[model samples]
Target: MENYNVDTVLKDIFDSKDSNNWKPSDKIPLVTKEIETLKNDLKTFLKSSDYNMDAILKESQELCDETNLLVSGMEMCKQEIEEETMAEILHSIENHDRLTKELESVNFALNIVYDVVQCGKYVKEFDDGREAQSFTRAVEAVYDLLQYIEMPAEGFKQLDMYNNTRHTAQLILDSLLSDLYGEWDRLISTSVKPGNKKTTITITLNIEDSLIVIDVLNALEKSKKLVEKVMEFSQFLLKDVLVPIINNDCIVFAETDELMTITVNQKPDFKPAYDAVIANLRLLFHYLSNKLNVEYYRDNSIMKMMGKQICAEFSDILVKDCLIDTIPNNINELQSYGQITSEIEDFQHFLVIVKFFPDDKISILKYVNNIDILFASKSSQYFLETARTIMLKDLSVTMSIGVETIPEGNPGTSADVSGTEEEALKILNKTMPRSLFYFPRCMISKTAQELLDLVYVMMEQAVQCSDVVCKKLYNTTRLVFELYDAVVPYHHENYLQTIPQYVALFHNNCMYLAHNLQTFGDKWLILMEGRELDYPISFVDLVQKLRDLGYRHLAIHMQQQRKQILDNIRSSDLNCIVVKDVLSDNAEAAVRQCLRQLHLLKNVWIGVFPINVFTRLMATLVNMFVDELIHRVCTVEDISMEMATQLTDMYTLVVQKAPLLFQNTTDVEQYVKSWKKLQELIFVLGGSLKDIEKHWKDGTGPLAVHFNTEELRSLIKALFQNTQFRANLLSKIK
Candidate 1:
């Protein structure tokens, strides 16, 4: 309960005691009768209304108590004034109490007004239509009340309930939409006349109009509740304007659920239209944000319009998605892969351009397909599948049967009667493409392998070189490069298409070229080296950046070339084992086997290995062959002229095969050492061993020409005991 100053009220009212109405003696009864009337009036007035009756009832009860205080002393006090006049004065106090309750109602009115303003200020848009209209009506009600009783600050000061309420300067901004929109549309000028005739136009906003919006913005910012209200309302207006553009006219198909003709063939030409849209939006939203000071509203509203209204809706409807599905399936068709890849690149490029909004810090690209991830992972996998399919179908690659071996101790199994797999023969077979005739025609296949190459390059950045998926993608790319290179000859000879026998001739020529490359060696290797491409990308260009990574040389088929002579020689080594080398029964066989194997191994390496290594293998084989023949002859029991002739013949045959080995005098001398040693051995047996030994020691005898005294004595003493050697010695001596 509030403390009431009834004494002050009575003192002020009684200050008129000296007025020319009545004596001081008569005033007492007048006050007594008036207080009794005031008490009766309170009981009557309290029954009028129930709203805010707590304060009204409290005031009435307090006034009744005050009446008792003022006139209760009537019997003890004297009367001075008229009873009727004092009763009128007390009745007037009842009216003042009622007026205070009405003032509380006025404060409640201001609270309602501030609330409607807050509704417009708080959010970007009234997403709920019913709520938006309810707030609008509430603001109008406040505006109407503002006409009669301007909200006095004094009414709100006493009330704790209405203390924090803010009456915005933009009191009825919700009411200003029609006129502001008119100004916007007028500035935009809906039907722009390019020439004499007015054209039907869709895009209404322009940079020039942003200036008009600028002035309007300056005025609106002065009333931020109005700016916030406009920021929210502008969205509905923007959607009404922009969403229709996407639904009606779009570069790509955006499904707006409209009954219109949209087909794959009718794909939108988006660049020019998007250029205009972006330019207009950039300027329009920026000016709105600056003028109204609601950047969040401007950016959010436009992003929603672009993404939900335009990009996302259109992406779902694009006919290109169907093409993306088939690209993996049609990897073998070069033209189809090329076309599909070209189209996808264009699509992604367009999205990149569209998503770029200079005015917006956050991209409005949420609705996109995220083609980066798609191309990196899925598209790459699809391309690999395509390449593998091509390799399987066109190249004729398949699993091959390996050599099967039984345990070392197993019997020959010739006695086995049953046909169980344990007794079954381990078979040997080869698997090869039917048309490995494909080799000589080095370049008969072409592929759209560059797409896979691009994918490899892109993914390599995201992964390591050793990563399995990356390695597989790289191999696929490399094979595609191989296929492209294989048929690259036709690329340079486009006019050959008119020639009737061009394909046949070209294939025959490739075969001829490959055969020459295999047989002739370094001339072809040198010619083919660094000839893959003249620029950055070649069929053999290092995709993995590792050496020897891509297409095997067309001459790889040459690995299968005939080696019948060398094979027979190798087979010969398994059949022969010589005793004392050339003197043994199988010495010639061993010598021939060893020399032929060495020749085959050396000649084979000439095409692949460095020249020094080939020379070394040749030298080793020659030296070993000569040494073996000489050693057996020197140790033979019947050392004679015939043995010397045979040993010399073998050395000459070897020199003939490889003339470079004996090109120098010293090398030729080294070559003859075995022949010379045989001759001196036969001479020592023909002559006296004692004299040969003495001459050998002095370096002056027939044996001394080749051997020292110790070697001569050793040879002569060994041969002297064998009867067959002594007989050949006697015959040679005769």
Candidate 2:
């Protein structure tokens, strides 16, 4: 049966044709063959097997019956057991639920008891630590109590014992903080306050005591108050001690072995005062560190607290109030302050040693470092005052006038003239005008020198300041010179008018100031060029103004001199010489008087102005006299032989004496513009008509060059006969 192929044979019969094409003949053989094969396989299976079919069926029916009977019996037994135990099971479940509730209640009560007992134990430890003065231990116990009370057993917070325990811990913590702060305040007061002690401040606490306080405050996270308390103490010291010492009140500073009371005296010295301040601070730090044991607590130590407060006091109180007033006003006084800056630097180093100040936090030191600028601001007034004194010393301040040497290869002075005798004379004459002149150098009055010295000192100080402050100081320096320009002209106007020497000195001073200031601003700018400047630095405008001022003074004085010279000529009555038979002594006396005035001016202006300017001025005055003399002579309508001779002699006297005005440096004609014209007029006045014609040379000679045709015609009509020859000569003069 297991090896039978019945399905394969049947499928072969069916699949031999399509279903629609099925026929008995096509399928009968395949079906019959499969049927025969099935029959054979069945017979073989039956013959080879050894089994009893009836017996096997009987055994299966017996097992099925037994299974049904067992199931019925089990169901009946389960129903009986359920009916008997149902009420007892429900009762036991109720009992178990009630007992569990009772057990939970008991455990909750035990937890409450444990939490309250633990809180009470910690409170007792906190109280014990407090009684023993062990603040760290007390704060630690309170810390534990606070931790436990944060989340106690459920419903434990509503209990009276729980809240009472937490409240007790809180009270202890507050008390500890208050006591610790009190101890800190005491430490500060004792360390900083001098009280009535004349010398060393006594420290009542040991190092262990100070450390105990520091540890307690830090444990409670309240060290920030330390800095606040220190600043308050610093203010107290500033008001009571520092203020008196700086203000030069009855309280003064004196050195002692330790913290000492300020000595009572009227005298105040900044050095000793500052030294006393530093000494007190040193003793304070020394006592606090050595005796109080605060050095061990580096973060919140007393030294650090006081160091920060002292740094602020240095800028706000010491620098602003006390040290600022100590700044010197003058250069001599400034010597006293040389070590003050160093002392401040030493104070900075001391701060560094104490490790209280950080390198990045130097704002207070910056204020102290600006001491130079402070000095400049204060001393600028001194600079101005000194300059004022020098300028106002006297109207007639003098210095021995010395000739400054001319550099080689520079333009020649009158002394350098060299040519033919006449050519050299002409060259010397050309050098006389002040308009085209050279000065080797001009001398300054003693007042001017003193002012310049002050200026140099001020500019040097200005260069040492910051750019903004330096500019201010330099502007102050400009004001100094401006003061001179203003003060001299105003205060000494009378002296300038009456005294030639004073006028000369004022002019030279003005020139000297102008000369130095020309490059003054630029020179300092170069020295101070490390910073960028916003505007140009130059005194070009000021130099021009000073020059104008000098010229104005000199011109005003020259006006008076001109009037005197012209008035002397008028007094001579030179018109009488043209018509009088005898020459008047008044003419000679007038020349002498004019020479006296010229000599006086020459004496004052000789060393003051350059040689050329002095000579030019003198020649200009002489030329004015010549102009007046000629005008007087021309006014005469006719002249006798004696009159012409007298006029000629007067001309000779002037020509011979006028050269003295130049100090013999040049000839008179060289500087005097109309000198030759005067000579030609004199020649024509004294000569005959033939001689005059020869001198005139038909309008091209000296006479024609000196006088116009009309002037020559007038002269000929007055001194010679109005004949056909004279008329012809005057016509020919053109």
TM-score per prediction, in order, is 0.25, 0.49
| Per-residue lDDT of 69 in model 1 | 86
All models, RMSD in angstroms: 29.5, 12.7
lDDT, candidate 1, 87-153, per-residue tens: 7878899999999999988878777666445444442232232255343433343344343234534
Give per-residue CA lDDT, model 2, range 8-113, as digits (tens): 7567667754877888997778778877877897778767779876688999999999999999999998898799778788989999999999999999999988
RMSD of 2: 12.7
Where is the poorest 10-residue window by lDDT in model 2?
197-206
Error of 1 at 378 (Å): 23
* Local distance difference test values of all predictions, in order: 0.40, 0.69
**Model 1 misplacement above 4 A:** 1-299, 302-585, 594-620, 632-667, 670-697, 700-710, 722-734
lDDT of 1 at 32: 79
